[model samples]
Target: MLRFIKFAKDALLAFPLTLIFLPFSRFFSFLYYYNKLVIWIWKNKGDVTYHDFYSPFRDYKKRYALYENILQEQKLKEESICYLEFGVASGASFKWWLEHNTNIDSHFYGFDTFEGLPEKWGSFDKGAMSYKIPEIDDSRAKFFKGLFQETLNPFIQSHEVNITSSARRIFHMDADLYSATIFSLSQLFPYLKKGDLIMFDEFSVAMHEFKAFDEFVSNFYIKLRPIAAVNNFYQICFIVE
Candidate 1:
């Protein structure tokens, strides 16, 4: 009789709890389906899938291959190019560019906090990737220390004349956040020209770089064609049209 009474009491308590949560469950179900439809439409509207731009490669870094291919195809090394890199962690990629692009007149600029990310990212907390700004011995490369918002505008204003006159501009976006990526794009929008290339390091992160690029392009009515993409989609290169 005691066990039966306990069971009856538990059932009575669960009834009110279920009733209270039922509305939330239904609301979430609706939202889930709505988002699915939106994503479907988004995918159908020119977003390239892995199957659409995959090439067989063995034992090679696809991102570097794409960058080199684009550089060679555009003959950027033969022209006066202003290369800008966002999120210059440890200056490894920046140094690589300095060594490879042998053009005497080419200039490279790198932007970073040097204190690392301002906020938390996936599996990484704030201040992650922090490093001391390395001394780049090359005269062609310059590093700007601070947040992008703090550094980019002042630099752009100061060099507006030179920026306008540059023959070619290449943007290397290693920024891993949506805000940083989109902000950089907006700040540089006035300077972006046809035939320029923008390479994204974390393009496959849907909520960050990919979303930022999509919204920025749509907002600015900027047309872009995918020149190359890694098989895993971690990196992608696009030519602005």
Candidate 2:
């Protein structure tokens, strides 16, 4: 009886270990194949992101509301104010914003590599080189190609959207990478007005982004404040007024 009891205990302990090992092994295999799926999606659709990359239903609602509320609170009087988004994935957010806001006069611009992140990312992995997205046909919408440093300032200058010294009324940063997000914010931060809005889609996940913003605020003593926090694990919205 004693021997049987000892044997049973050992078997139970070993059972848990076996269970853990099997799931962990399966999990790694799943992760490997999942990454492959992402790469495949990017290859075929360089212009738009693959939906499987992120949860559309759960993650998108808060962001959409944030944009809508910002526009409402700012009370932007222009028939169409210039709005810019950095790192547009799949153009899904752009499509949602355009349709919901119905600011016929508002010109929405998105900037991306469309080919994915550049090589030699300073602190992060380069995103895939491309994605396929639907054609953004809203007269108020446009897409710019290349990196932020290469495309943003020049595009703003050409459009003559710079009022006084600032370039656009609203800007959304979703680059996800540290260098790209910081660079985009630095270049455009100067142009943000007292009533302008800027949203960061990766404020939490990307340590670099949070660190960069903290450093900038400390150095410049900027007064940007959070107006809406997406009650989630990631994403935050800020308003400068």
Error of 1 at 18 (Å): 17
* Range of the 10 consecutive residues with the lowest summed lDDT in candidate 1: 50-59
Q: In candidate 1, which residue pairs clash?
A: none
- Candidate 1 residues lying further than 4 Å off, grouped into runs, are 1-60
Tell me the tens digit of each residue's lDDT in model 1 across 172-220: 9997987899999998898888888898888766667777887788899
Each candidate structure's TM-score, on Cα atoms with residue i matched to residue i, is: 0.76, 0.65
Show model 2 residue runs off by greater than 4 Å.
1-61, 71-79, 119-125, 162-168
The sequence of per-residue lDDT tens digits that candidate 2 reaches over residues 125-230 is 5666366544976778888888888998888688754333343366777777768877887776666678677777755442445655655566666767666545
Model 1 deviation from the true structure expressed as Cα RMSD, one decimal place? 9.7
